[model samples]
Target: MSRIQQRVAEAKAAGKKLLVAYIVNGDPQPEVTLPTMHEMVAKGVDVIELGVPFSDPMAEGPVIQKGHERALVHHTSLKGTLELVKQFRQTNDKTPIVLMGYANPVERFGYQAFATAAADVGVDGLLTVDLPPEEVVILKDALDAVGLDNIFLLAPTTTVARAQKIAEHASGFLYYVSLKGVTGAGHLDVEDVKSKLAAFGQLTDLPVCVGFGIKDPTTAKAVAQLADGVVVGSVLVEKMGSLEGQPAAAIATAVGEIIGGMRAAIDSL
Candidate 1:
């Protein structure tokens, strides 16, 4: 099974919520990004969604936009991001790494070559933002050839027909958008998420994870109580930005505090 699938199964068995952390691969530069990843793993992060620096991330919000800009300032690209993953494998292999980004970079890199390189560097899955279900079939085949899972993202606006189609192709896990707007732009509606989950679950057994605008322990805890997993990106990215001018230790320390609270929410459950 895919690591993400395995994680869901294990979390289900353990009656725990999956804690997913996301960060741009080279933002603040990989010098800090790599260690932050290892730090997250050490703090028991269930999965890591490393954003591949794409020129345009339409699905993302301002926080991630700024992160992409920061990553670009350091000349981060698809190939360089893959190299960071390769370096990550030198010390850790257990934490699942999902490359999340837009399809533009993958196309620019040549889809087949990018998938091959990502798999070679130990990436476990992918979450391409712009590649809708219709176009995903081709990329899915490419990833499957390399033994990688293609994670599909669903949202509130998704029709039953759309959800069903995405679920059919989804392998790693389904990322259910908790809100309608871009990442970090909306608030959680427990009732709404519950409603959507109920509706979407009718079509597929894939473990559903909710993200977008999830910011703190209260939100994370609430999501853990509802969804199978909770993904935090913009909040963490914002935290990274907040630690500016502080030493690397301060950066790591601040992140640990944020992750700790979110993790506590899951543990309390």
Candidate 2:
């Protein structure tokens, strides 16, 4: 099993839900990224979805869009993100690191080369936001060869047939976009999410992780009760942005507290 699968399996065996945290690499500043990542894991993040800065992050909301812009100012390329992962691996070898970004950078990096380098740097998965299941074969083949999970997104409007098709290509876990819009867009309707997850349960046994519209411990707990995991991004990124110009330790502490609160809330279940 890949690190992601193993981590999820471990959480399942222990009767715990996964808490996947997302943050842009080189955001605010490149130096702060590494410390924040370590603090996040220490505070109870099960998997880390590190965002690679892209010029046009279509799926991200204003907060994360600003985060990408901030990272871009520091010239955080795909290779730079990989180097951060390599640095992260030195101290932490267990937590799964999944690179979340667009397809253009990956295409420019070459599928085989990117997959090889990612695996070498301890990356566990890839979530290309705009890459659909139909166009993911070549990339999936490369990732599969190196034992990296190719994660996909399933939206609330996805048809049953389309969802089944996505499940066929997804591994490690399925990221269920809780909101119909971009990341951090709408209010989460718990009942709506519950019903949708129930529909997904019939199609695949892979872990379904709910993201978007989950901004606090309350929402995380609500989603945790319904799905295998909860992915939190915008709120964290917003928090990081608010703490910009502060010391790295301050940023890490403030962000870690948010993760800690969610962890406590989820464990309370």
Candidate 2: which pairs clash?
none
Q: How accurate is candidate 1 locally (lDDT)?
A: 0.85
Model 2, 68-136: lDDT tens per residue?
999999999999999999999999999999999999999999999999999999999999998999888
TM-score of each: 0.96, 0.99
Candidate 2 has a TM-score of: 0.99
Q: Which pairs of residues have clashing backbones in candidate 1? A: none
Per-model lDDT: 0.85, 0.94
The CA lDDT at 18 in model 1 is 90
User: lDDT tens string, model 1, 88-151?
Assistant: 8999877789999988888888888988998899999999988888887778888989989889
Off by over 4 Å in 1: none
User: Scored by Cα lDDT, where does model 2 land?
Assistant: 0.94
